[model samples]
Target: MIDLVCNVSNAVKAVDPKAKVYINIGGAVNLLYNDRLLGCIDGVLREELRSHPGPSGPEPQDPWETPAVLDTLAYSHSHGKTVLVGSRDRLKGARSLCVRAWSHGFIPVPQPAWTLGCSTPPRQFGAVAPQWLKATSKSIIRRPYTSIQYLSLFDIL
Candidate 1:
């Protein structure tokens, strides 16, 4: 596992020095590997790939106080870790996303604008909130909650 992580990390760095990558050993992997294995993974990271900006500042937070995927991503960027909250049930996890992000050590901040797609919904058009699209450490994503469509007329969101 350590070898694979090191090789992949090295490969990503070689491709784009600024490209960020994380080795996730959570969920099922946890069922297979114990704490010691996780520690070894951390050790490999420390020895081979240095953790940067140690304790740069306080934890990140969302300005709007809503559970948005973009905010979670922002938090991940500031912390230098890949943080993801599943979106299988967007409505169910909306606010919880913010809570989870807070617990996961992510730092949310104002982000730059992004053009996710052209909804062309007129005055009602939607996209990932501008604040959520701001720049952060490059990382993988699972789309923001704000991007979910199929709104109902009575939806109060």
Candidate 2:
């Protein structure tokens, strides 16, 4: 999978170096966190993984605070990738996550409502996302790569 992602990224970059390729391995759906797998990707294909390392899981350790999560943040930042964090709404300490992310030089991007939680009472579906992105990007980021390409397909751009 790492090779595939790298190869595809290399091929695309050959054609359009300006194009950004963001990676999100979502979750392993296994009995473990698969840190080694992510480490491998970061070790060899770190440059290809952009914007952020996407976090997903309902594990005991919230994705926002886990070692894997923090490591990815540092690794991505070191590689000059914009750090975007998508915290699960079900995860505890959301406000804390936001503060920690800000302190670590991360911009909090909205997770699709489906991933956050479809059952909860929806609030501020449209207004808050753009405001949050614009405010954080302007305040913290020197060069925000939280691009509209991903959101455009979903009609959220």
lDDT per residue as tens, model 2, 1-157:
6565556556545665544555553442221134433332322111111123345533354544456655755665665555555554433534444455557765544344344432222243321333422332111123324332221112211
Tens-place lDDT per residue, model 1, 1-157, is 5555556556556765755443332222221133433322211111101011236532334343333434434433443443332222223333443344345543211111012221211123222333322434443333342321211212312
Off by over 4 Å in 1: 24-82, 107-133, 136-157
**lDDT value, residue 58 of candidate 1:** 28
TM-score, prediction 2: 0.46
Residue pairs in collision within model 2: none
**Model 2, CA-based lDDT:** 0.41
Off by over 4 Å in 2: 27-59, 62-65, 90-95, 113-157
